[model samples]
Target: MTAPAPETEPTPPPGRRERKKQATREALLDAAFRLFASKGYEATTVEEIAEAVDVSTRTFFRYFASKEDVALTSQEEQFYAVLDAFRRRPPEESALTAMRHAGTLLIEALEVDGLADERMSRFDCLMRLTEESPALRAGSMERTRRKNDEMTRAIAERMGADPERDLRPRMFAAMASTAFMVAADAYRMGVCGFGSFSEAVDAAFEVLEKGFAEY
Candidate 1:
């Protein structure tokens, strides 16, 4: 009798493969941030980051267009999270109110991710990278402006107003983003002494809602 054929291993499903790819991408981002923090962004190379993750330099480029893209991952993540939260806010809520709630929810979600401190540290690292590299700074600002425009579109949709003709949505999106950044900068600069970052954000929103007339 012929010997029974040996069983062959089955290929993993597409979902499993996709999940592995996502895990690899996140690992690369984490390693990139750590390296950028310790060695400085401009001082770090793509090959070094790839080696840290046991991946080829080609793999790194596959996930991120450049070192600057990897360095800005944290900001990009927060931008999307805030935008998503803003989109999910109650339909009847005012634009400012939705933004305030979205900001709070975004921070809370970050804390829940169990990497609040790490994320803040990475953000600080990104800030340093921005200062040290003109290319990174320009890229960061341009990306931020794009995010603001996207947020403007979201605000316009939520308000059922014309994105082109109605200026309130554009203004609200830009001002809200600026307020959040100001609070974050204050926290980073130690000007927000004795207060949590969330508190700083809350205060910024409060000032905005109050029309800033008292200041």
Candidate 2:
């Protein structure tokens, strides 16, 4: 007997809504960064960015709550990705070891498609804006605090640390994050000067590896 004809799978509907949302978000981010770099963060208005992006002011609110949110909002996904990796590290791995691995993965992920350079440039601009505007600085600090909390929790979980009993993982996470940030910041500064950005990052990591006792 002949087998019954196979059924064809249904195709998914076109992702028009999702694609449009992504395009709109990118447009907003691009416009905001341009305006912030050229006009300075404090001088740039939400309406101005919305106008530049050809979006309504209400649409801007749909994506970000305020001007400061624009900068911090973009990093939310990256921050969580790293945190999730950290939390899922093997229980036997030392906090420092896990952090080193996670940091390397995070850096590698950022290096795709000449994104490292683009990200560094944007980061430097954001740093300058943060320094120039008190509101931006405060917003940046809050974002950093949130990231640190997430990292600490991830490290604690990986090390099987009890919230009330162990502090080492928390400390390790803090130090590791500081080292990574210092490396990135130094790279940014070096790039602004005459040094190679990648070389500066390597040097910073080398110093971190040598430990503070050798300093």
Top model number, TM-score: 1
Those runs of model 1 whose alpha carbons end farther than 4 Å from true positions after fitting are 1-23, 192-195
> What does candidate 2's lDDT look like per residue over 137-160, in tens digits?
898888888788777777777667
Per-model RMSD to reference: 11.8, 9.2
- 93 Cα displacement, candidate 2 (Å): 2.9
CA deviation > 4 Å runs, candidate 2: 1-16, 191-215
Write candidate 1's Cα lDDT for 31-122 as tens digits. 89888878888889999999999999999999998888888877898889878877877777777887787777668656677766677888
lDDT of 2 at 28: 92
Best by lDDT: 1
